[model samples]
Target: MSTDTQHGESSLLIQLQHGLKREQFERALHDIRAGWNRRELWMTLGLHDVRQRYRRSKLGPFWITLSMAIMVLALGLLYGQIFGQDLHDYLPFLAAGFVIWGLIASLVNDGCQSFILAEGMIRQLNAPLSIYAYRGLWSILIAFAHNIWVFLGVALWFGVDLNWNLLWVPVALLVLLLNGLWMALFLGLVSARFRDVPLIVGSVVQVLFFITPVIWKPEMLPGRALWLDLNPFYHLVEIMRAPLLGQAPALANWLPVIAITVVGWAVALFFYSAYRWRVAYWV
Candidate 1:
């Protein structure tokens, strides 16, 4: 607390801030790298979010599992009849698609609120902005883990053939998780600045659920298979759902998905680097 010591500490703080201000890209990189280095902190925050959400409920996160199971069964039965597919074959496909879609849709929708939801922490703490994004995505991963149990149960009940192709599922899920990271960073920044972004995201996700082939199959659209080719969400779902249902995804699916991943990250990084410093103010 001596005068010279206090002066030195103040000078150090100014130097650090000035260094960060020197280059926006470097500042953004530092934030992302620092957030990764502080995995323990973000992981703890992610777990805390899950706990807070299920605090007083007896079933806790299983409630999500139950709800997902009900949706799959109800849709599988209704849509199976509509699409003229056997229930046994249709249920497994529907279950896997719905489970994967739930994760993808939730990540995109929730990414919109990642920063805004953590407004108080951003204002009062010195953590990197990307830390909130990481935490939000981690929470989504945890929820996905819970919801996937429904798929397992459906698979068991239907006796779907298991093949070595199932091994690719983890890789596909990892790719989706990578997409989730950039999405959280990009959408979080935009949503913090524009309050309407989350609402728009929600509406889009709702519409996509019907059109993205979750309840129906591509075979249902035989003449215009191009529709599935153009839908990025379909590509995402196909990469995992096809493998889970014991079929290999086409090369076409992987090509567009990888391209989108690269382009999406490029766009996310540019805006995140440029506007990251403004997040606290916006939120």
Candidate 2:
């Protein structure tokens, strides 16, 4: 094309880039609403992500199950012996704790990359940022499903009681997913702008893995149980793990988790509203 023609085209593109748009809240709302309306898109993308990751592997996603099974058995036996707890009790507890921890940790770690990983698509398409967040959470949930088989097998082998309280499993999962949404939005936004945020998030999650009750029982904390009570992950894990182990989680567990979910969403919503417009540039 001629120089003038190319210059005019570039000017038009710049105008479109800076064109009139909705206010921040409306834009954020539209991003979410439009994303929800296109659930199939993100769900397919998410599942495809899982499938693609394991595409050439002989065991595919079953590798997740196998690795988790090995980790649970190894850790359960070692920790049970060290803590002098009954194998029957500790194995099932470890199984439940590992499964829940995997879900929480994966969501937080991967959620940080939701937008940055989708940079190409975000730049090329006029889609909602929430779509990328959904894809991240859905992909993690798919992997969680794969890892959960180890827990089910452990429960069955140990003959853990299948009480009606197990219904809380899905409830707890729903709460986790809700929390995942806001976390994905908030973390994804921050990580897109600050490349260091993902590194920081991964490091924090790694530290939390040891501190959280994944391999160790909270009873080890003794009179310091109040510290565990303050940990949101402890409650999240207990709500799911207690039910799976045929026990009811204390009311304190449910209350703090619910409170965190509420407050987290509010903060995420405000931050998202303020920063959603800048994501494209940041990414």
Candidate 3:
């Protein structure tokens, strides 16, 4: 072919690539909207997952509450003595932070399997892939509901003050859930293609729990520390934990949480739009 003919073909290919990308982006948005519109379906599936996990058990889902309560009590006693902190203050803080961390961690860990574990459904069903993400998030939220009571009990035991700021807990949870949605979709997509991603994520989350001030306090740091500010998990926990402890989250915390949410969704949607259709095949 002549130089001009080859150049024209290249230009045509570029145009087609852009058009394909635009089409994929539109379908991605539709999948997200359609999945949300079918909330009732995912919600039921999520609830069934929770029940199925505890079927034939005496305590059912309340086992989550019992297990969390035991963990909070054990950690509170051990760490309170180790850190020389008063139980009254420390337990409530630990409980609030730990429960919030549970939700965040579970959202991430289970989010990896959001598509992988739904392999059968992905292959056999024609539902939007986002529904699997939603189902995983809802299951995590159900567990969070069970675990929140542990924090409430700790608050009551410690005589933690309740104030108008407590109202922010719901708003904080709503924001966290928004973040979780993207996390599930993004991580689920990646994990579907790379089986090892979930293992890596699980290990990372375990390490983060130790360093993110769940069983400890940020104030324990002797001086102004940069790592605490840089730790997104710290900000995430603080956003919810502060409200539960009857305080407004610092502007510092809100800024990072909001920034992460916006950036996370943008990245998640870009990849999800580009590769969502491949999830079925990847799984």
The number of clashing residue pairs in each candidate reads 0, 0, 0
Q: If the candidates were sorted by their lDDT against the true structure, best first, what order would they fall in?
A: 3, 2, 1
Candidate 1 lDDT over residue span 55-170, tens digit each:
89999888889999999888888888887899889999999998999899978998998899899999999988888989988889898999899998989898998788999899
Error of 1 at 44 (Å): 1.7
> Please, what is the whole-model Cα lDDT of each candidate in the order they appear?
0.87, 0.88, 0.91
Which residue runs does candidate 2 get wrong by more than 4 Å?
1-22
- Whole-model alpha-carbon lDDT for candidate 3: 0.91
Q: What is the per-residue lDDT of model 2 for residues 40-158, given as tens digits with 9 covering 90 to 100?
A: 99999999999998899999988888999999999888889999999888898999999999999988998899999999999999888899999998888998899888988999998
Give candidate 3 misplaced runs (Cα > 4 Å): 1-20
Query: Number of the top candidate by lDDT?
Result: 3
Measured with C-alpha atoms, the lDDT of residue 160 in candidate 1 is 90
Provide the lDDT at 55 for model 2: 96
lDDT against true structure, model 1: 0.87
Candidate order (TM-score): 3, 2, 1
lDDT-wise, the better of 2 and 3 is 3
